[model samples]
Target: MARQTSDCPFCAIAGGADAHRVWEDEQVVAFLDTRPLFPGHTLVVPREHVPTLTELPADRLGGFLAAVQRLAGAMEHGFGAAGSLVAVNNRVSQSVPHLHAHVVPRNPKDGLRGFFWPRTRYRDEEHAAETARTLRRALGGSS
Candidate 1:
């Protein structure tokens, strides 16, 4: 993200302009995604307000992904998301150049049929919990 953070929507969200905050720090913020594919959909953005992944400082990249991992895991276990897809677009689908990640929750029986990227439900709550636990430990959440 080359553009200045003030011109970015993520900056506004980071500034606490009325957002459903899930997690936040000085450099990153996580909140609910309004137009969600499933419940507990969230977006994690850098507070520095870079427009794309390439612009993020080297040290900050992992932190952002860590947030995504933690949130995705939590959604899987708590919300029974079943499955999830995390995507970061550059100029291709980068509607907001502020380097935001879309953590979309997926369900197997949701009637969402697509051969492109098939998603299956978690085997059971235990399966989901185990996955979340692993992610939490790896991503620097509450291990």
Candidate 2:
């Protein structure tokens, strides 16, 4: 098991601090990104505190990706997005020093031309929850 850090925000969320949690299992957790590229943007992370993908145990990679796959589908179907942009930053541009895969909902003309991400915000918590509910249902349950 990766050691949990005392000050990692992702760890705090994984440890049950108030977060807009979208999906979770024994090994992973998915949550809405507070500053999102799109409203339904989600972050899929391992519960263990690995700082980068290379640090993630091989056995956990499959399960982590499985969760990311489910979230990608949910982003497309639940949010009515045309597709999704799934990516992971190793150490560069990784605002949070944890292993997380970004699942951003995409549309044809959403104005996101390239990797130059211009983030947008949810209208409010209700909006965030509504998005979360949609993803949760698409994920098959709160679990």
Candidate 3:
């Protein structure tokens, strides 16, 4: 069920508030990000006022992700971008509590490093492999 609060900006947008809407349907909405990483950066969100991805109902996850995928393609085709960076912030650095996926258009040598954090290398190949193994174990060996 869709929940809209008067205070949440996303909910306002979802409820037909003024925004640069790129796409909208019964399931989700896509709009230009107010503070864009690039000219074509867009935000995709479920119509429901879900605070985070984990809170989004399982049945809605696929459709929401598909909407994000569609927006990624739009970033390339609509803005002539070579590719796009899709990201979701759960809590940390989440400027808003509403769940949103950022689709930032990308080109070669964009100079925007991953989250602008200094890149670091693993101690060695074994160290990298061990990190992957740990994650695999946490995921019940799904990998």
- How much lDDT does each candidate structure score? 0.68, 0.90, 0.74
Residue 23 of model 2: what lDDT? 95
Ranking, TM-score, top scorer first: 2, 3, 1
lDDT of 2 at 49: 97
Against the true structure, what is each candidate's TM-score?
A: 0.72, 0.95, 0.78
Measured on C-alpha atoms, candidate 1 has an lDDT of 0.68
User: Residue 78 of candidate 1: its Cα lDDT?
Assistant: 60
Top-scoring candidate (lDDT): 2
> Candidate 2: where is the Cα deviation over 4 Å?
none
Q: List the residue pairs that clash in candidate 1.
A: 1-50, 1-51, 1-52, 1-55, 51-97
RMSD in Å for all candidates = 7.5, 1.4, 14.9
State the lDDT of candidate 1 residue by residue for 1-143, as single tens digits. 32345666778888768765666766688766554444455688988768788988899888888888777777676666787878888878567777888786677777655534433455555544454454344345663
Between candidates 2 and 3, name the one with more favorable TM-score.
2
